[model samples]
Target: MQPSTLDVTAERPTIASVVRSARPALGLYVLFQLLAFGVLWLLSWKAGVSPGRFVGAFDGNWYLSVAEHGYDQAVTVGPDGMPAENSLVFFPLTPALTALLGLFGLPLLPAALTVSLLAGCAAAWGLFLLGRDLAGPRVGILMAVLWSIGPGSAALHLAYSESLLVALVAWTLVAVARRQWPLAGVLAILTGLTRASGSALVAGVCVAAIVAIVRRQDGWRPWLGGSLAPLGLLGYLGYVAIRTGRPDGWFWLQGGWEMHFDFGRFTWIQTLEGLTSNESSWITVTALFVVLAVALQIWAWCTRLPLPWQVYNTLTVVIALCSSNYFQSRARFLLPAFVLTVPLALLLAKLPNRALAILLTTGALVGAWYGAFLMAIVHLNP
Candidate 1:
């Protein structure tokens, strides 16, 4: 008899296969980032400013200030007896890491950009791994590329926390899929340290744990991990409570930054206004994407997204839309809700290779154009 083509004994994929699998998507993402960088640089050069000065120009500057001088140095009181601009509202890790990079003689914006670039790459890899585990390698590859070039993806490659937050969310979900409860919870805690949005991760873990308990799981790992996941968020709140001598002090800081919890009434108005008027191109773009995201959210539910992912995505959208200010920042805020890539990835996986390549290239061009618009027109560090 001829030797069997398939061995009875199977071997797991080699590390090389894993790396090669992620490379195309990551390479595509990086290519677009470079393209955007080139366009933004040319625009900046014409405007008599170095592109380096703009990486962290908006919130990037805020993080740099937080890194260089402690939050206390940033407290200027408004006429209404509140902080006019407060650094405490921002998370600490980005600023802290940027400060460390700055100590090595790099300028703060450059250091922050370095941190963002590295984190964004990790995020792409994590998205690939998570997508592969959820569907298949094809879906995973598409998911990573789609997310890296999605609307408002400029935020992912900028000096902002969204990149790192998505990186943490992706890996935590990967750990969850592997049933590595402790690792998932630990990453969730780190996610909390990265942003207020970390609450979505904690919610996902909690929902997953509750379901596990209801199903009579074998051990306490789920509960233990769930318990561990909220510490990073609570720890920061506790610190603020101590410093300000008020139980709601951390929340007050949010108000100082003009971010108030309003149950999303204001969000609908903002969306409707933009959808109805041509007052601001950015607002119109934001409204259109939010509509697309809502459709994706519906698709996720119809496709039965796992309970944990569902919980995370639902809570993220709720938290974001309920916030009272910074309507234009909606794009930046929603970019980290990376689970929305699922439907798009599924669709893209159905395309023939050549068509997929053309579609991806077109998406990259759209991303690069929007990145330029954000840099040159919106005057915001996406």
Candidate 2:
């Protein structure tokens, strides 16, 4: 197959130019983030918990630990005798960025928070670029706005790695779509270091590169990029293997945490049960979102998304659904699949101005409340 027709053979915009063009999207993103934080603050006040504390709860604390002290030498076991929270399960890039910021004497928490906030901005900008290239400037702005109001966007404001991961994933996809092979490869490497879900990105990049090579397009650049794309993930996995003296050290670590791939069996069972059970709202809400996400994937397949985007989005949702991890966390896991929002954004863009404004505003409010509820009320990882 030939390269994507979306490939840009024109001169690339400079960083400053891209930032200048992305100002509106960035401004809207900041506003949405502030609104989300405001909702979280009010909810936290009612719940008698500090908003800052809530943002950095659960996985954020582990990220902070890795930032401050690096990974522990031995895994600690919980009272139930399972291997306790291990920083190794957490990727390295976010903590590394947080630690780099901590060098300026900021505390670990603030450093991690700062890293997330800045990365959130970059993610918004990158999403804008991706959408603009795929559709138009209006869709680009909507893409950023939609991302800012995502149900899992609470993690963006938190000391979590989602912001960094999405930023890398967005820009890498843009590079791939534009056939900037070398840049795509570099970003894919960093993305691989950001999260295990980044494997989806690595797969997308490799697929695009292979397509170009088969068609004798882009010369040897695709070969180089595809070869470099997997290094970061393999490097980390190799380190773990050497450290643990096991070929599947990463999977072993995950198994200890009760996080293993079950090919959607666990998700299917839990989702059905959660939908019918009168358990916590978290389960019901999470299950509903999972169902909606699957529906969105079906919708996306019927749309005209490019091959790489299709591959990336499908793999991301599949990974999120197929994992045996915490069921409630699956929604947050789907945060990186931004392409799934394109159809909704396109539909919103077609509405009359007033109606569109009302719809987006309503979505932002509901999404904000959902995020706050997930964190403060349900007291769960988001």
Candidate 3:
């Protein structure tokens, strides 16, 4: 006699089921990162370049110095004993981590590499958690893989804060989605301390909480989540105030670095003025892309997607546009602006597998190039 058919609907996936589903995809993601790293390394080697020499460029050196020596306001003074401005420019987190790594007997550069790589891996896991919550385990793993092997992968290899910031932002979103308000808030706060644009996370969380309250859907939990999100940001601001005798010490540092945020000013005009006639075609293309990114954010806002994602995307766009430095490369700065990715991801979810794979593969290639190029330029210039 034939056995009766088992009803699939009767069996819901447990935590174990979810993990089992995600494991293979997650493994593929790790393999992708390894492959990307190898490819980049080969490119550098083909150019007869040493990774150490390339890594020695730009903000990397300054960060290494900060790690070796704790921050000193006096360092802001020049040889003439006047405030040189650049002295007080660097943020504290990267260097602090470098110092911690020294306890393990690692040199500054190696420590930075190790930290960036670890942070990248952690970020992938966090992104997986985020995607898992919003979509399914399979999509989550795919998103993580895309992020790790994409153009942004180069940021993970450099001594920059991109990896750390990505990890913090991803985990913060994960915590928020899980309804762990305090953890979310704390992570958001740490993100703010990590980068100036990080305040966007706090604003997003607050807006989300407010929406929940307005709907009268579990007020206390959302309120608590919102309230806790800014603590890391506030703590850092407090430190700046105590140290520099101004609550807005960080803002002042930004201003000193010529990164003024003037919303009403003509961003396009300022960007054009900064470009030279002889600059590469890539520069002009990138400038136009930044302008388009700003426009996209405005369009997204008008279309009225989810309020939290809207707020997060809008704030990041505004910050990028109003930024005085590298306004032309706002696209690069806004790479971690993942709220914009939500709508895109939703759209991609409906596509055929072949189409989705093509789109993701192309994005990953571009992301890897951009991430590496950004690091290379910064290292060379700094």
The whole-model C-alpha lDDT of candidate 2 against the native structure comes to 0.85
- 112-168 per-residue lDDT for model 1 (tens digits): 888888888888899898777666778888877887777777776568888888888
Q: Each model's TM-score? A: 0.90, 0.94, 0.79
Q: Show pairs that collide, candidate 1.
A: none
Top lDDT hit: 2
TM-score of 1: 0.90
| Candidate 3 Cα misplacement greater than 4 A, ranges | 1-48, 73-89, 138-142, 145-153, 215-219, 264-267, 270-279, 295-305, 327-329, 352-355, 374-382
Q: Name the top TM-score candidate.
A: 2
Quote the lDDT for 72 in model 1: 68
Candidate 3 lDDT over 1-382, as tens digits, reads: 1112112233455888756665755575567656555655655565566555655456677778778876655525345533345434565677788889998999888898777777777777776766666555555666676556533355556686767887888887666555566677777767876766778878988887786678786658787878877876777777766766666776765655567777726466655744546365445545565655665566555543445556776787778677766543555466566555544555566788898778767766665555444444333221
lDDT of each: 0.78, 0.85, 0.64
User: What's the ranking of the predictions by TM-score, best on top?
Assistant: 2, 1, 3
Question: After TM-score superposition, what is the CA distance of residue 94 in candidate 2 from its true location, in Å?
Answer: 0.4
> What local lDDT does model 2 show for residue 115?
93
Evaluated at residue 125, the lDDT of candidate 3 is 73
Q: What lDDT tens digits, residue by residue, belong to model 2 across residues 1-382?
A: 2123464866888989988889998998889889999999999899999897777788888898888888775855567756654678888999999999899999888898899999999999999987777677777889898878877888888889999999998988888887889999999899989899999999999999999999999899999899988888888888778766778877777877699889999899888988997487777878888898899889878778778888999999999899997887887789898888988877777778789678777878887888898778877777
lDDT of 1: 0.78
